[model samples]
Target: MTRLLNEEIIKKLVTMHDANRIIDQTFQGFGNKTVINPSKVSLDLGETGGYPFHEGFVNAMPAYIGDMDLAGIKWVSGIAGERREAGLPYISAMILLLDPRMGEFISVMEGTYISNLRTGAQTANSLKYLGFKDKVSIGMYGAGEQARFQLEAIADLYEITELRVWNHRRETAEIYANEMKQYVSGETIICNPEEGEKAAQAEILITVTNAQEPILLREWIKPGTVVFPMGSFQEVDDDLILSVDKIIVDHPDQALNRGALKKLHKEGRVTEENIFTTLGQLAIGAVEMPNFQEEIIMCIPIGTGAMDVSIAGHVYKRALEQGLGENYSFINYN
Candidate 1:
């Protein structure tokens, strides 16, 4: 029997805490070199006639986590410049879970929520392991859906003293700050006129923007500040990349293939040697944290298929326990 789970059910079953826990365990497996996650395959659908209004791409990510005994693939799509005009999400995805022993199909589930949640969990984990301060003052560059999840997951784990937000559109930042105020115990300020001022004030700076070029600069970054840039595109200047005290990635290959470090990696500005360690190494105590001094640290997550499988596996188990989805026979024995 294959269970069919919808977004509503997935949203109901998975929480920020669950995502953080699952991702933490998965990274431990990664640190132990026990998980198998191949590079994602992407197909560019450039100016395709199907989507007359927007360009899109499709990606397939597959993985197997040995420790959890779960195998799965996430098929996802992203369409550009449709959110405002078309009222559609920029990304959508689905996850297919398989029985590890027999290779039998187990369940099909919505993946957008899982994707957002796991990405957020990854950011939270980076902050947990690599960040210097117990209490943080956050400055965010973008106020989109992913930013919301990042706030939720981080807020669940730490005490945020202040959240200062800056977006290209002031109204968008204002709206996000208003909606997100409930999540933070401290003040949520929408930065106006001086965006760099806010970035300088942050103990933990996060950028989730889609900008193609750098918006953050090395001079603006303060000592002992941890930066998390969640987008594939560049958000910070090259000087920041070259001068950061330490650089940590979720996966080195994936980070180089995409994310904020990709451009630098391609141009020979940064390499595998420049990276301090992967977050997985930090998670499992495989690497030692350097002595705390006034330093700048950057953590970039390109997002991994193993993370998807781990969270999806957790959702599957909970759904099965509660009997939340409809089960149908996919294979017939005559």
Candidate 2:
């Protein structure tokens, strides 16, 4: 019966990351789950219609986490129109956590913050597994919130000496570079990617844009580089889709079907032949890393509800102990 807000969620996420103790237990998800995400429908202020929406997968994400045995549900409903409204986000989410013992509603809060954190967590994990430890340079495509979070997560995970950032917009890239300078306290290589910067410099490359087509052109990536295609799979070039020495996903069953790799497979551009391994398999020690070659390795995160709930449940338990939140009755039965 306690309520937590977005700001509260952000605090918890930050706290968890700072402590390096966020428990992530993800359930099964679709591999290359496809649905149209067009925005043709429109709606009046009072009346509702013209949602101008297209299909995107809605998933049931459930998980039990640590510290109070947290469990919750996250429904990832995709609709692309919110960006234009300047009110809602491209992705809208609703999450509910219940008392596992009694099945009573415990909390409901905005989910976008947590979603981005999950991506950030996975991105940090990717860097830990594939990135060169001594490399100080980070090349990022897409200067959005996720980009910021990726940098934050990386700094938390590594002693990033400096950064190199790129975005299509010069102003955005410059601003990002400058902001990063404040954080690094050292020389930074931040700028609009020098035509083909992806493959040129960064020891670690991250893509988090919304481009419908490729931004990280295959030829642009450097040899032995670890690439994180955090944005839509559609934005990564076909060459990258086919050329990588290792392709990893949080879950292959879902990654193979609905992940970017699956999208390529559907386009007849890539097949099972392209995917060398998945993170889950790697976590289970089913596969091993290859020699450092001029190879591009990309890992995709398909926001899992289980991970979300597990994290939230733990956060909620902590919040209650801190004497946070107010009790309210969501449903009144006389």
Which candidate achieves the best lDDT against the true structure?
A: 1
Per-residue CA lDDT of model 1 for 268-300, tens digit only, reads: 888999888998899888897876448888888
Q: What does each candidate score in C-alpha RMSD?
A: 2.4, 6.0
lDDT of 2 by residue, 1-334 (tens): 6566565544753453732335222311111121111111222221123333442335556655434455677766555454446565566676788777888878876776777776777666555545346434677777778887777766766777656677877788777766766456456654554555533477677778876667677777767777777664466777777777777666545565554565777777666566676554454344666666666677775545555665666556666777666667877866
Name model 2 segments beyond 4 Å from true: 9-13, 16-20, 23-51, 54-60, 64-69, 77-83, 131-136, 198-200, 268-273, 284-286, 332-334
* TM-score of candidate 1 relative to the true fold: 0.94
Collision count for each candidate, in order: 0, 23
- Which of the numbered candidates is closest to the native, going by highest TM-score? 1
The Cα local distance difference test for each model comes to 0.85, 0.60
TM-score list, all predictions:
0.94, 0.79
Weakest lDDT window of 10 consecutive positions for candidate 1: 45-54
